[model samples]
Target: MKLPLSRRARSAPLPGIVGAARLDIRTKNLLKRLRPGDIAIINHLDLDRVSAEALVEAGVVAVVNAAPSISGRYPNLGPSILVEAGIPLVDQVGMEVFARVAEGDTVRLDGGVLYRGEEPIAAGVVQTAESVARATQEARAGLSTQLEAFAANTMEYLRRDRNLWLDGVGFPDLATDLEGRHVLIVVRGYQYREDLQALRPYIREYRPVLIGVDGGADALLEARYRPDIILGDMDSVSDMALRSGAELIVHTDREGRAPGAERLERLGLRAQVVVAAGTSEDVAMLLADAKGAQLIVAVGVPQSLEEFLDRRRSGMASTFLTRLRVGAKLVDAKGVSRLYHPPRPQVWPSVLLVVAGLVAFCAAVAATPGGSGLLESVSAVWNDLLDWIRDVVT
Candidate 1:
């Protein structure tokens, strides 16, 4: 069972087969060269669509997830990938069980008994193997179609928005009148984690101006980076981020009054209300460029066409204009995490907010009837929102 059969005879010992070697060592080796169409043993059910697509394309027939049985943490992209690819997938197998079958072990299947080296670990839901093959062809076709549409949208955005590329514009031009020597832009969402991780190392070396656009403020705070400024409507940003050391810029419409700007003033966080036409991210970039920022690092800025489609943005024209406004000072945070090593945050402000929330909840519950009801709803909603925030940050 070591691998493909040796020339001598049927008497050679395989690497992870019975009597050949210990289980852990064998399993590790098996993992090193794992290919598609093999039984997959996993640790969790949750997987993103990207990873799932990769596994399916690789042709892995099944996966053994070791995660909690019912977390529903994410879609088991792997299972769906297997199903669509016409491969078979099963879940929840501990590592101890999977080690029993090695690269060349013999195993039983529905239609026939087959060598482990040749057959996948599980079977698809469809009764016939021929049906599985057909499904795989269809799934691949569908994936291609989806990807094509994704590509078309992305190109359309780039075409509409000219700022992603600048001929030679650089630092000095992308700043406001007040002028920040350093500037950081935060765009909140799943991409924020990737962006922050990329920019974390750079923050220490170059302390730029910090500006959070709504949820981006939460992102900045999560990374332990103190924001010097925040831009956007007040929605999605935490009160703590607003109150934290940054100045606020409330994005408004052409009418010259923003409800969000009014709220910032009430909190004693003075703000400039800018009436703009695009998203908060676009405005933040535009304002930084206008403000004369020497260097601007934008985190979680969307680039792909599929991403724009998902966001349902009208086009890339606005962002393009903003980019041209900022010029060459802008650097994408999407790739930053790969090369940066950021410092650990000394502040536990986000964690403390949880404690403060609980205390507030207790006080509210102990107060009037109306207060208790209000606290209950707020607590649940706040927790759900916090969970979403946690997802974006980590």
Candidate 2:
């Protein structure tokens, strides 16, 4: 028997694909409007894995890039992921394609050639697994230079954010007291969803102060957990997550300008504003450490050198310095999941077991000769009780 094709297989482009064109030079911005079955026209160079995953999740039928999908820049894996998902990726079709095709216009992809109606608009390379692999291998040759630049950026970051490390720079008082308690800080990165799944038992047992960093709040909501605290620029989190009664803290730079604060004001929600340098995740860790959290568990925090670079951060100095400040108390989500064996089953299960045993005993008693008379007496009492309830209703 032939089974139905999977969603990926069904959505996969045929020899010729026709779909509504959706163009965005900014891949992140474009994702907001992109719908499944729409063709995405992006100008992303060296497309990072996170953006690629977002495109896949958006369910775009195909991708048309004005820029090279992989420019031999340190083995970026975005293109390969798209191709592997059976989404056709046509790249380097020149910037003119943006001008030729209007948004919402019907566009066609005949292999690497893009067409609007009968007229062929542009042509470019169609990426494949083999080609992506070759490009990745070539990109690795440039890693040494990237490493040197990263080191210089880290040193510069340390110099600029010295006050953060020394004075705990601007930690705010929170209603949720974190002292001697575990704190879970989540960022929407990597296998954050998977990490959250692995942490179900931990969250249930410790009831840690749950903190969501921007879009990470939505991640928590998706996992069916309401955040205790939501922090960041507030751009990516949903209004539902914001209104879920989680305390909001808007992340700001040393200048104290919070972009997220204005958004909340328009929504009629109040939030505490925090000023600091570095990414919001850095701010979150420092805040948790200063608030006297005994243990800080991070989910989807960027840990590797490649991950930070993939995020296109100029320096990880703040991250490095923040980690140092929170040393001994910090633990990765993976470590928490693996090292912390789930606590023994709790009171509810024992209560359930006792209830089941009682049910069995009652049934056995009802089947016995002497207990039959007792059950009959109880049934007559129950009928009389129902009659009384009926009389009261009348």
Estimate the overall C-alpha local distance difference test score of candidate 2.
0.87
List all candidate RMSDs to the true structure: 23.8, 9.2
Query: 1-394 in candidate 1: lDDT tens per residue?
Result: 4555556455654332111111122222334345644554444433333334445544555444444222232112234444556644433444544455554344433332212444444322222344434433444445445456545655664453334223222213222343657677887644577667666568778777777888688878888887777777785577889888676777764465454566666777766555555567877776666556677777767665434422323434556556666668787775454556666676698789889998886886769778877877988999999999999999
The lowest-lDDT stretch of 10 consecutive residues in candidate 2 is 308-317
Per-residue CA lDDT of candidate 2, range 1-394, in tens?
6556796676665558999999989886788899999999999999888889989999999999999999986777788889899999999999999899999999999889998866799899999988998988898898887777767877777777767666776677799999999999999888899999999999999999999999899999999999999999887788888999999999887687765677798899988887667889988998888888999999988788667666655536677778888999999999989988875769998999999999998899988889988988989999999999999999
Q: In model 2, which residue pairs have backbone atoms overlapping below 3 Å?
A: none
Over all chains combined, what TM-score does candidate 2 have? 0.80
Worst 10 residues of 1 by lDDT: 16-25
* Candidate whose TM-score is highest: 2
